[model samples]
Target: MPTNQIEVLGHAISNGKGVQLNLDIAKLHTRTKIQVPIIVERAKKEGPTILITAGIHGNEINGVEIVRQLVSKKYNKPECGMVICIPVVNVFGFLNQKRQFPDGRDLNRVFPGSPRGSLASRFAYHIIKEIVPLVDYCIDFHTGGDGRFNIPQIRINEGDEETLQLAKVFAPEFIVQTGHRDKSFRHTLHKLDKKVLLFEGGKSLHIDDAVSKAGVSGALRVMQHLGIRDFSKELESMDAKIKKPKVVKSSSWIRATYSGMFHPFVKLGSKVSKGDVLGSISDPFGYFERNVKARFPGYVICINESPIVNQGDGVLHISRD
Candidate 1:
């Protein structure tokens, strides 16, 4: 790899150029190989490279759509930096319409993976080895997993000022300061001194048009703030509004007490106080009802979209100061 050239998915993209390439990961039981698409837009001048990854979980399609919209419509060879967009990271999960790999592993939880590890692990290793080392920033898009719906928001590591500032540029409705989890892409990138912003919106396996719109605009705003895109002239020309996303330091999930049909009273983005009646769970016969209350004061960031839930199922996610 030279200073003026970048290689991805076996394609060498030189300065002032863009290319769509594919990297083959492995051969399935059917002897068919799986490959992921990669799009790189390199600038002619010296600047940073921002990596935008989506669809790590196959079911999280809103982010995938957002990346599609950006790369297809909004992206250009940056005036300064470069843009690397990988619209679908998990080929198996996306094809199977699943959140986890066929082997029951969460791809997002297997970062800096082993080259000779499981399918998910190998994919993670490939990204860490080939992609993560080349980028200065990362914007990973996601949605609420397991039948949950999330308000459009940006999730960042706790107390990271630079990344926090970038998240602010996106100006989603909420900015969550969460601790880094083990084997997560954000944590791994943080360890390498690369700032990664996790954008959470919509629901798994479904597309919300409004959420998609928000996601697309948020990403453009981030690029604008980074000097990769023109904000006022271009965004305003498209009637985009940049609002300040509120920051919430703490959050918790409300779980079901027993298996039943859950009827949620509060919706996503609803503000709640301690002991607020968030929802109710009842048996099929209308007996054995249990009220799910808010344990602390916070705003509702995520809610279960599915009516049926099992005992100990997370129904709502709340965020508080």
Candidate 2:
């Protein structure tokens, strides 16, 4: 729907106005109220409404940082459409630097959630019911779970030509064609016929300057592409150069064979050939070591940065084709 008049978090927002609302759906066990701030900005000219969200997983501070930069730099203020920024969607996880809700549930797995379900589910339900309906397209930011560091990339389903095209416009380092999680926000939005660009970058609990730049620049490019605003001057000022994104059709993870201290050898976003030495695992005392080689040729998009590893732990993510 064209964004002229809309209501976000129960407040009516008219054209050319901005409002900050709190999604105070729940409180902590300490009885202290926690507010998930939702920032909404609408242009006088009616156009598509785009929802920019991050912090679905509380530990993914890189995602939160990306959205924060957008809001802080006023990049979310569009000239033709409505822009909604939810910098911290899962405040509970963010506050504790955890990955799940207070009820120990991953919020991303509970899309279109039940009002009568878990804490995460109820919050998810509210998001879909109250905010998502007004959104036309969405950019959900994320980062690698655990300690895996992902290069800047946009994840989309293989056949979504429109979203794939838009992902190209975002100009991240990579575009990964991957299936959606069963009940993820991306899947739910897809079911509702809303296009979503799921961006993955950096790692959880940490923020990288390059990744933040990529995330912000990509959003600017998307908004500019949609005619929501002209970011010509802003784009010129951005330091992260537009990447010729490599569309990854398939990918796989390189698991550690022997539990030991892990070290990755290849640079992220670089192509690798079969049998290449990607990394090594060794005993802490330097008594045992094993070289991890690439099984097939692909690009290294993610690496496990943790210094320790276990048997069968995924240490690197490489594209198959």
Candidate 3:
């Protein structure tokens, strides 16, 4: 396949160039057509095709910003192969600033979707048809949803050497072995035998500058690893120092046992020992307080930012050390 010439959304983008195209997905109640933005950059040299996708959950804006920072500059365009970036996949949910589609469906759960399915499924189906087949690897950006803040991390299916190495090259604080649902994009891509790395950080609907910066740099490193650019020169130019992430096979979320005003003692990325007090939950009147403790030795990867919590709500997520 020619790396220089590529077609997307009925438009042909040629070598050493870039193009922004709009893909029509649906119509609003007011009869306005909703078009998803796609940016394609093809290099003059042949190498690998990588897909950078974001905003699968519309409330997660960090990924969107990461994508923006990546494609904003002219020089950042690949020197070989091609880069196809979809900054916001859930246009409807993004506009509404919600996690689910207008039909109340989680878009990420329905992938390689059906044409006759719900709006989310149809939109996903279109993306799988149009984008998935063209890419050699995929990097899906995400963040913790529902008031949870996560340390910058990479999640990949365990035992896939190619994908694992790609995740390592990205160099997040942790590399988690996570299983995806049957209809998820990750699962579908794995079924098609494509290498995938899912990078996650910060929180939904909020931006952490450090996490955003890390995301952009990690993606560039992955591009370098794929031979999209000169490796050592690119790293030196980027001032990128690679770190080996702690690889974990499993993790757990600690749930709140008492409903009240919670005060956290540890922030994201805090290391903790088994049975250490993580936080305190007290009544608004300050009559009594309950301590939330870690169940095992690990590092806190995610914490609930919201002070108010109910019984049985997930308060913290730990990746075992």
Per-residue accuracy of model 3 over 145-239 as CA lDDT, tens digit each? 87888888998987777888788889988899887778888989999899988888999999899888779889888888788875566457767
Q: lDDT tens digits, residues 60-175, model 2?
A: 99999999999999998989989999999989789899999888999999999999998889899999999999899999999999989999999997799999999999998899
Best candidate (score: TM-score): 2
Sort the candidates on TM-score, descending order: 2, 3, 1
User: If scored against the real structure, what TM-score would every candidate get?
Assistant: 0.94, 0.97, 0.95
lDDT of each: 0.86, 0.92, 0.86
lDDT string, candidate 1, 1-321, tens digits = 245677766677788888877777776778888788888888777778899999999989989998998877856458777899999988789999998876779988998899999988887898898888889988999998878999999999998999899898888999999998999988999999998889999898899998988888888888877887675676777676777788999888888888999999987888899999988999889668989999989899999988899988999999867
lDDT of model number 1: 0.86
Cα error, residue 50 of model 3, in Å, equals 0.8
lDDT score, candidate 1, position 115: 91
Model 2 bad stretches (over 4 Å): 1-4
